[model samples]
Target: MMQYRVEFVTLCALMVLAAGAWGFVALVQFAHAAEPHGFDQRILLLFRDPANLSQTIGPAWVHEAVRDFTSLGSVTVLITVILIAMLFMLFSRRPGGALFLLVAVVGGQLLNSWLKVLIDRPRPELVPHAAEVFTLSFPSGHAMLAAVTYLTVGALCARVVHGRMLKAYVMSVAVVLTVLIGISRLYLGVHWPSDVLAGWCAGSAWAVLCWLLARAVLSRRRAGEGLAESA
Candidate 1:
C-alpha cells in the first residue's frame, strides 16, 4: 500500500510537470510573437481606472494592501522566510530536509532568472506601475518565486504533519498565497497577465521536479539500507 501511494504521487507529479512545461512553452511562443496578445493588454487594463490609466481601480488602501501582499513574494521576504524555516529544520535535526529546501528554492530562483533573460519580455506599459520593478517581465519573478518557495515549504510541512486535514490546509494556504501574489502583480500593473500565468506554470513545474528528485534519492537510500541490513 505504501509503495502504491508513492507510485501514485510520482505519477501525479510527473503529470503536473508535463502540463506546466507545456503551458509555459505555449505562452513563450505567444509572448515571442511580433505583436503582443490583445488579452494581455485587456486584462492589464481591467485593473486600471478607465478615465485615468495612471491610477488603479481601487481606493488608496487597496493599492497599499496589494503592495503588502506582493511583498510576500519579494526576494527579501522570501529569503528571510526560507532562512527561518531552514534554521527550524536544522534545529529539529532534519539537516537533510533543510539542505533539500535550500537547493530547491535557490535553484528555482536561478531558473527564473535564466527564463527571464531568455524570454526578454518587456514590462507592461499600458498602465502606470503601482510598484517598482527591476527585472525583465516575461515571467513575474514575484509570482514564480512565490509558487516555488511557498509550495515547496508547504510540501515539506505536509510531510511532517499528522493528519490529512492539516496537510490540506497547509497546501491550500500555499496555493492561496501563490495565487494572490500573482494577482497582485497584475493589479500593480508591473506584469502582464500572461507573465503571471507563465510564472505559475514554470514555478510549479520546477517545484514538482525537485520533489520527485528528492523522493527518488530517499527511496534509493532506504533501499540500500534495507539491503545492507538483510546482508
Candidate 2:
C-alpha cells in the first residue's frame, strides 16, 4: 500500500512539473515578439552543415539513426503503437486501459492540430530541412505524439508491473525515446527548437491528464461495484 501510494504521489508530482514547464514554454513562444524567424537560428544552424544546409552535421550513419528515431513519431508508427497497446490490453482482458490510450492519443492529435492552426507557425527555414514536412510546425506532431504514446502506455504498464526497478525501467525508456524523437526533429532541420519544446510540454501534460482521468473512472467503477456487492 505504501509503495502504491508513493508511486501515485510521484506520478502526480511529475504531471505538475510537466504542466508548469509547458506553460513556461508557451509563454516564451508567445513573447518571441513577431515570431522572429531567427529566434533560434544560431542553435539550429549548428545541427546542419554551414556550407551545405541540406546535409546534417554528422557521418552518414548518424543521419540513418536520426531517421529511425523520427519514424517512431510517424503516423503509421503511432497508429501501430496504439493498435498494439490496445491489443495487449484486450488480450489481458483490460479494455479500459486500451480505451484510455486510444482516446488520449486521438484527442491529443486533435488538440495539436488545433494548436498548430492557432499558432500558425511555419517550419524552420533557418536551415534547409533534411526531412520532408507537411504540417505547420508550431508544436511538433512527432514530439507531442511520442510523449503521449510512450508516457501514457508506460504509466499504465507500470501500474500492473510488480517491481520498482522494472517500473522505473519502463518509464525511463519512455522518457528517453520521447527526448530522442524531439532531438531528431532539430537535427533534421524540420522543426524549430521552440516547436519541439512546446510539443514536449503539451504532450506530457495531456498524457498525465488522461492518466488521472482514467484512474478516476476506474475508481468510480470499483466503488459502484462495491456498493452493489454490499447491497
Candidate 3:
C-alpha cells in the first residue's frame, strides 16, 4: 500500500510537470512576439515613472533592498553555492546525485545564455535601470538561474532527506528564493515583467526535468545493485 501510494503521488507529480512544460513552451512563443507588442511597454511603465523616466516606482530604500536580493541570483553567488553543495554530495558517497546537480545547474546556465542570445531582446529601455546589466534581457538570467539552482538542489535534497517537514521547508525556501529573485529583476528595471515570467516558466521546467533524470538514474542504480546482490 505504501509503495502504491508513492507511485500514485509520483504519477500526479509527473502530470503536473507535463502541464507546466507545455505552458512554458507556449509562454516562450508568446514572449517571442511581444517585442513589438504594446502590452510589454505598458507593463514596464508600471514599475517606473513615464514622465521622468529616470525614476523608479518605489521608495529609495526598496531599491537598495532589491539590489541585495537580486545579488542572490548572481552567477558568483549561485556558482559558489553549487560547488559547495556538489562537493558535499560527492564526499557523502552520492556521486551520481552530485553529477546530476552539477549538470542541471550548469546546463541551465548555458541554456539561459543561449536563449538570451537567440531571442536577442534588449534590456528594458522604458525606464532607466536601477541596476547595472551587461547581457541581453529576455528571460531574466537572474530569475532563471535562481529558480534552476534553488529548486534543483532543494527538490533533490528533499527526495533523499528523511522528514516530510524538512522536505517542505527545503522546497519552501527554494520557492521563496525563486520568487524574490524574479521580483527583484522587475523592481530594479533590469528586465521586463514578461521576461521574468517566461524565465520562471522555463527555469522551473528545466529543474523538473533535471529532478526526474536524477531520480531515474538513482533508482536504476539501486535496482541493479539489488539484483546483483540477489544473484
Candidate 4:
C-alpha cells in the first residue's frame, strides 16, 4: 500500500516537471520576432558551400541521399508505431501507458495540423523543392510527431523496464533520434527552423499532458484494485 503511494507520487512529480519544461518552450516560440531568419537560405548555403560538403561529395549525390532518407518518412513513422504496439503486446502487464502514447501521438498530430491551417505560413521558396508538399508551415509535422512518438514511447519503456541502466540507454536513444529527425527537416529544406521549434514545444507539451492523465488513471486503478482485494 505504502509502495503504491510512493510510485503514484513519483509519477505525478515527473508529469509536473515535463509539463512545466514544455510550457516554457512554447512561450519562447511564441515570442519569436516576425522578421525572417532566412533559415532555409542559410541551410542551402551550407549544402552548396564548397567548404561545407557538396564540393567533396558532389551536389547530385547529396540531393539523392537527402531525398531517399526524407522519402522514408511515412515508413519510419509506421515502423515506430508498430514496434511500440508489439512491445506493449508482449508485456501485457500495463496497457494504460501504451494507450497514453496512442492518445498523445494521434492528438499531437491533429493539433499540429490544425495549427498549420490556422497560421498558414508558407514554406521556403529559395530553391526548387525536392518534393511536392501542400501543407502550411507553422509547426512542422515531422518535428511534432518525432517528439510525441519517440518520447512517449521512451517514457512507457522506462516504466515497464526494471533496470536503471537499460532505461537510461533506451530513453537517451529516443531523445537523440527525435532531435535528429527535427534537424533533418531543416536540412532538407522542407520546413522552417521556427516551424520545427514550435513543433517541439507543442508536441512536448502534449506528451507531458498525456503522461499526467495516464498517471492519474493508473493511480485510480491501483486504488480500486486494493479495495477489491481487501473486500
Candidate 5:
C-alpha cells in the first residue's frame, strides 16, 4: 500500500510539473510575439466580420447576460463555492485535498490578476465595444476563473466517480464549459484569442499542479502513518 501510494504521487507530480513548465514557456513565447489584444482581434482576423453582436443583441440582452456572467465576479460566489468544497473535504477528513483545491482555485485567481497588471495590455479598439470595462485585458479574468472553478470541481468529482469513464465524462464537461466561457468572450468581442489561450494554459497549470501537490502530500502523510503503526 505504501509503495503504491508513493508511485501514484510520483506519477501525478511529474505530470503536473511538466504541464506547468510547458505553460510558463508558452506564455513567455506568446508574450514575445505580440501584446495580447485578446480573442476579439483573432476573431476579426479569422471571420473578417466587424459586426458587434453585443449591439445587435440589444443593450438589454447585452447588459443582462454580460452583467450576469460577470457577476460570477462576486467574490462572495467564489468564496462560497470554495468554502463548500473545503467543508466537504474537511468532513471527509481530507485536509490535504482541501488545501490543494483552495490553493489551486484561489491562487490561480491571484496569478491571473497579477499577470494582467504586469502585462497591462489594452483591450482591442479595432471595433466598437458594446460595454465599457476598465480592467486590464491581456489574460481574460473570466476565462481563468471559469477554468479553475470547473477544473477543480471536476478533479474533486473524479474522486467520487466510480469508473474511468465517469472520471473522463466529468473532466470533459469541465473542459467544455471552460472553453465555452473563453469562446463567449470572443463571440461577445470582449477578449482576444491569445488572452483566452494564456488563461487556459495558466489555469490548467494551476489545476494540475495542485493535484500533484495534494497527491504528494497525502502519500507522504499516509506513508508516515503506516510507518508509525508498524513501529
Candidate 6:
C-alpha cells in the first residue's frame, strides 16, 4: 500500500513537471514574437485608469497593499525567509532537509536568472511602473521566486505536519501567495502577463523536480536501512 502511494505521488509530480515545462516553452515562443501579446496590454490596462495611466485603478491604500504583497516575493524577502527556514531546520536536527532546501532554492534562482537572460524580454512600457525593476523581464523574478520558495517550503512543511487538512491549508497558502505575487507584477506594470505566466510555469516545474529528487533520495535511504536490518 505504501509503495503504491509513493508511486502515485511520483507519477503526479512527473506530470506536473512535464506540463509546467511545456507551458513555459510555449510562453517563451509567445514572448519572442515581434509584438507584445494583446492580452498582456489589455490586462495591464485593466489595472490602470484610462484617463491617468500613471495611477492604478484601486484606491491609494489598495496600491500600497499590493506593493506590500509584492514585496513578499522580492529577492530580499525571499532570501531572508530561506535563511530563517534553514536555521529552523538545523535547530530541529534536520540538517539534510535544510541542505536540500538551500540547494533547491539556490538552484531555482540560477535557473530563473538563466531563463531571463536567455529570453531577454523587455519590461512593459505601456504604463508607468508602480515599482522599481532593473532586470530583464521575460519571467518575472518575483513571480518565479515566490512559486519556488513558497511551494518548496510548503511541501516541506506538509511533510512534517500531521493530518490532511493541515497539509492542505499549508499548500493552499503557498499557492495563494504565488498567485498573488504574479498578479501584483501585472498590477504594478513591471512585467507582462506572459512573463508572470512563464515564471509560474518554470518555477512550478523546478519545485516539483526538486521534490521528486528529494523523495527518491529518502526512499533509497529507507531501503538501505531495511537491508541493513535484514542482514
lDDT on C-alpha atoms for all candidate structures? 0.92, 0.84, 0.82, 0.67, 0.70, 0.92
For candidate 4, what is the lDDT?
A: 0.67
Model 1's TM-score against the true structure:
0.98
Query: Model 6, stretches more than 4 Å misplaced?
Result: none
lDDT per residue for candidate 4 within 76-145, as digits (tens), equals 6545774666467458866555566667777877887887887767876544454666787777777777
Q: Which candidate is the best by TM-score?
A: 1
Which pairs of residues have clashing backbones in candidate 2?
none
Name the regions of candidate 4 deviating beyond 4 angstroms.
Answer: 1-35, 38-76, 83-87, 90-93
Worst window of 10 by summed lDDT in candidate 3: 28-37
Which 10 consecutive positions of candidate 6 have the poorest summed lDDT? 28-37
87-125, model 1: which lDDT tens digit per residue?
988998988889999999999999999999998888888
| Candidate 1 wrong stretches, greater than 4 Å | none
Q: How many backbone clashes does candidate 3 have?
A: 0
Listed in order, each prediction's TM-score against the native is 0.98, 0.90, 0.89, 0.74, 0.76, 0.97
Q: Please identify model 5 stretches exceeding 4 Å from their true place.
A: 1-20, 27-40, 45-77, 91-95
Candidate 6 residue-wise lDDT at 194: 91
Per-residue error (Å), model 4, residue 163: 1.3
Which candidate, 1 or 3, has the higher lDDT? Answer: 1
Candidate 1, residue 151: the lDDT equals 95
RMSD (Å) of each candidate, 1 decimal? 0.9, 2.4, 2.1, 4.4, 4.0, 1.0
Candidate 2 residues 1-231, lDDT tens each? Answer: 987995887687576657746673664554255754465677688888888888798899999999999999898998998899899999999988899989999998999898888878878777777788999987889998999999988987897898989999999999999999999999999988778888888888888778777777887998999999999
lDDT of 1 at 95: 88
- Regarding lDDT, does 2 or 5 come out ahead? 2
Ranking by TM-score: 1, 6, 2, 3, 5, 4
Off by over 4 Å in 2: 1-32, 35-39
